[model samples]
Target: MKVSMQISFNLDIINKCVCHKCPVQNQSECVRTQMAGLKTSFREIPLNPHKIPKAYCLNGKSVCKGIDRSKPCICGSCEIYAKHQLSEAEPGGFYCIEGKSA
Candidate 1:
């Protein structure tokens, strides 16, 4: 069995929460930073809680439920991959497992 919850808060929204990669139209580096952050954040979570929150990570690594190759991966060509020492043979591709390409 599974359960879901939705929480929303309104506080004079200021800056638009756009991904850094989306800003200035730097899709490559933006994705790398976002992915790296997601991987690191998830790894920081403790396992004792036994509850993981969803909708947090947005590194663009997640695949569709039934799809094998969801989107074209640019990790191989990304600069972050080389800067951060991420490998292509890792289990989770993109930003999920190994994290950013930069």
Candidate 2:
């Protein structure tokens, strides 16, 4: 049987997220802008899911549409994915396109 858990939207999850490195988001200027924002004021501002470049699995659908869905998801390689048993979640890996895990 598959097991799953609710993912928390937190800095820890953000730190471990691999979505920033995903090929899907590699060409997205919007994602890049958000990454810059994250680097500068991640802790200063309350994190909004719409503003996060990565960790869409814990957050929700991405705000950027430039991401290419043809690429493979690297969630299987993320530390948070392993720790949270995200493989068992519905919609599995493409959280950017399929929305958050559940």
Best by lDDT: 2
**TM-score top scorer:** 2
TM-score for every candidate vs. truth?
Answer: 0.26, 0.87
The digit string of per-residue lDDT tens for model 1 on 1-102 reads: 121212221111101222222222233443344445654544553421111212211232322222223444344444433333345324323343333223
Alpha-carbon shift of residue 48 in model 1 (angstroms): 23
* Clashes per candidate (backbone, < 3 Å): 5, 0
lDDT at 8, model 1: 26
User: How well is each residue in 1-102 modelled by candidate 2, as lDDT tens digits?
Assistant: 465556667888888888888999888898888888876657655667787788888776888979998998899999988887878768788889898888
Predicted candidate 1, C-alpha RMSD: 14.4
Worst 10 residues of 1 by lDDT: 8-17
